[model samples]
Target: MAYQQPALPYADNALEPHISAKTIGFHYGKHHAAYVNNYNNLVAGTPFDSMSIEEVICATAGDAQKIGVFNNGAQAWNHSFYWNCLSANGGGKPSGELAAKIDGDFGSFDKFVEELKAAAATQFGSGWAWLVLDNGTLKVVKTGNAQTPLTSGQTPLLCVDVWEHAYYLDYQNRRPDYVAATIENLLNWTFAEENYQSAK
Candidate 1:
């Protein structure tokens, strides 16, 4: 089946102040949609034509010759996941098992935020910072453009896209400001919890 662009979990204007509708419009409607469209084209006449996005990502991972396939497919998957990672009335902190896991793994939610902030801020260029389940252990990891945890053994719980396109229209060159706002106001901990339960 040809991959399609997934809709944003919330309305485009849902996350205001923290993430404006204009940002979402160009980011999701344009940037993410482009990846979805490109992925479909790249896989149209190849083995990936019938494979799931995850399968294409895994199959092309680390194969330099298939970098285009990897880039488009992984970016499609990543943006889908990224959209679910945000919410209008989300963030603050989690409760239940997810809370315990965060505290246990990172000492405190503050520390986890600190770590995630550092990851996104220090990523150097376009990339992502993630909180993932690695060997049943909660961990934070970051990857460069089009790289995703799906190709790695870890299971991603939450992610923040630090690509300039993700925040340039809103926060401009201050990537840290965008990262901080997304973490504090847009993070969907409930979605993270759901991903965690499935990971285990």
Candidate 2:
């Protein structure tokens, strides 16, 4: 089956001032849609054409000859997950088991925030910062370009896309500001909690 871009969990303007509707229009309607289109095109009539997105990502992850397939497939999957990582009512600290895991893994929720913010800010180029389960422990990880934890055996609970296109129009050169707003005002902890429980 061909890959299709998933609809946003909320309306285009739901994220409001934290993320502009204009940004969502371009980001989701254009950029993400392009990735899905590109992936479908790249995989059509090939062995990957019949595989799931995760299967394609893992299969093509380190093959230099398949970089296009990996990049597009991963980006398509990543953006789909990233949208669910935001919510109109998101942000602040998570609660319950996921919250307890954060404290246990990173010392405190504040420290986890500090680490996640640092990972997102210091990623250096287009990429993502993620909260993931690695060997049953929660860890903060950053991946460059279309790289994702799925290719590395980790279960991604949540992610922030730090690609320039993700925030360029909204915050211009202030990537840090964009990252902070996303972490503080837009992260969907409920989504993260669901992922955490499923992974466990």
Candidate 3:
């Protein structure tokens, strides 16, 4: 049950012009990978050694004694989900049920993008901005550091990493630019749709 950095769905360079290969190289290859490594080591030979990352996250959440394990395990799962939330063929508007749901929940897709970007841009520090299903209602939520929506019983449909490491290389101090570009060109609506369907 050792956790590993999940493979990128596309080439590191595939998201070019929007997000650079170097960013993914560092973000996915370094930071994300490090979290997985830490998670594996922390849980080794412990009762959590046999638990899935999500299970460990849920079990240890809010327990100060296992905070290290919770942080690393949550990051491992979050990064895996974050990777799938982007794609070379993604971004722009979605179609079908996802489209209808976005309209229903956020008034319109543009508004949803606005809200998502604002949340990501305003996050005080290393954290995540997410689109999640909370009690069957679509909502936007932000979690600081290694926190995740799952611990709050929300099913995350989409997420954008707001940690400096996620954008510093690509957008420098221009976090808003990075957030805007990712929303416009990198978000994988298909993946979001699948997650939404499953959550429902």
Candidate 4:
């Protein structure tokens, strides 16, 4: 069966100003859709065609012959998670367990933001910055190209896509500005908490 593009949980304009409707339109409708289509084409009639997205990801991971499949499947999953990680009313500060975890791991919430911002800003070329749970500890990590935390033995709790396509529609060359705004105004703490709890 062909993979389907997952619909956004909210309207394209829902995360506006910080992340515009225009941005989501292209990012989700074009970029993400392309990956899903490409993945379907890549897997058609193959033995791996019947595998779930996660199964394909793990099975074909690191296999040179399957690089195309890995890229498409990982990007499809990453983009879906990335879109859900944003909301118009999101960002400010996390509370409860998420807050305490940030404080415990990074000293303070502000410091955690600073580190996350830096990671997003400094990810050379197209990639993503993630707040991941590795062995029950939270950490900030960056993955280049279609790489994801799943391939690294880390469970992703939250993520911000630093790919040019993710921010160019809004911030253009100022990728750092987009990252900062996302951290301040678009991060979905509830989604992060849910992912954290599930990973544990």
C-alpha RMSD by candidate, in order: 0.7, 0.6, 0.8, 1.0
Candidate 2 backbone clash number: 0
Worst 10 residues of 2 by lDDT: 3-12
Model 1 residue 106 lDDT score: 96
TM-score of 2: 0.99
TM-score of each: 0.98, 0.99, 0.98, 0.97
User: For candidate 4, lDDT tens digit of each residue in 24-143?
Assistant: 899999999999999999999998788888889888889999999999999999998998898877998888898999999999999989989999999999999999999988999999
lDDT of 3 by residue, 47-108 (tens): 89987889999999999999999999999899999999998988889999988988999999
> Number of the top candidate by TM-score?
2
In candidate 3, the residue pairs with backbone N, CA or C atoms under 3 Å apart (3 or more residues apart, or in different chains) clash, namely: none
What is the TM-score ranking, best to worst? 2, 1, 3, 4
* Model 4: lDDT of residue 139: 97
Error of 4 at 147 (Å): 0.2
In terms of TM-score, how similar is model 4 to the real structure? 0.97
Q: Give the C-alpha lDDT of model 3.
A: 0.92
Give candidate 3 misplaced runs (Cα > 4 Å): none
Clashing pairs in 2: none
**Between 3 and 4, whose lDDT is larger?**
3
Off by over 4 Å in 4: none
